[model samples]
Target: MSSPKQRHLLRLGLSCRKISAQVTNSATESIVAMASSTEQEFMPHYRSKLTTFPRPHRFWDANIASRVGEKLGFRLTDIGISDVEIEQPPLPTHHRKLIAPFLHSVKRAGISVYGSEKFESESQA
Candidate 1:
């Protein structure tokens, strides 16, 4: 049997075309994060979430705290999580010094560098 909220949603669903699977996991994570951050200040609520995924890692760990949890503020040591140090992941440097020169030389020699940021050459003035 549909609960009141479910029945209400069903009625709305007929009038809307934008239906998709529910956001159950994210919603639950947010609930937990909010409960955890009740007495917080300084960090904005949205910033507390650690949602950005930097590209360098070969694997993603699901167990890592949610973005909301991160935004809510966390102390890794107190959380009993570890490493002697903590640091933000390095961001990618999209520009390469050699890439511009290499591309110029190759195109002059009639070779085209193609596909992906790492190999693709950008034009420099």
Candidate 2:
């Protein structure tokens, strides 16, 4: 007979396996949706990137997977969306705006520069 903690660990591992299966299936569906009707399609390889990382839902670890799903334009599965809210990127508006001009200046000096005329046209468009 296993200890309570051991039993809990076993359950958690099983749950992770189930979640992986679901995500893999979902990925396969996504690939099918994107594939052309007559084209040979590649199999979906849904690697469980979150398994090794600490479970975000338990005791409120940050929801990295959830954020990733959001960025990828997918719904976070029940297992993916943890109780904890993900950490948000800081809005360094002043610093970002200051750096923006410098970055643009550097880009303008490069071979692939979007020159002043192109920039003005694009902005207008």
Which number leads on TM-score? Answer: 1
Off by over 4 Å in 1: 1-95, 116-125
For residues 55-124, could you state the per-residue lDDT of candidate 2 as single tens digits?
Answer: 4332211132222223222222212321111112332332222222322332332212122243223333
> Which candidate gets the maximum lDDT versus the true structure?
1
| lDDT of every model, 2 decimals | 0.24, 0.22
What range of 10 consecutive residues in model 2 has the weakest lDDT sum?
6-15
| Backbone-clash count (model 1) | 7
Off by over 4 Å in 2: 1-91, 111-125
C-alpha RMSD between model 1 and the true structure: 21.2
Per-residue alpha-carbon lDDT of candidate 1 for residues 1-125, written as tens digits (9 for 90 to 100): 11223211000010111111111112232211121222234234324344445533211111121222232223322332221111112223332322233233323433222321332333332
TM-scores of all models? 0.19, 0.17
Instruction: Assess the local accuracy of residue 70 in candidate 2 as a C-alpha lDDT between 0 and 100.
Output: 33
Model 2 whole-model lDDT (C-alpha atoms): 0.22
The per-prediction tally of clashing pairs is 7, 0
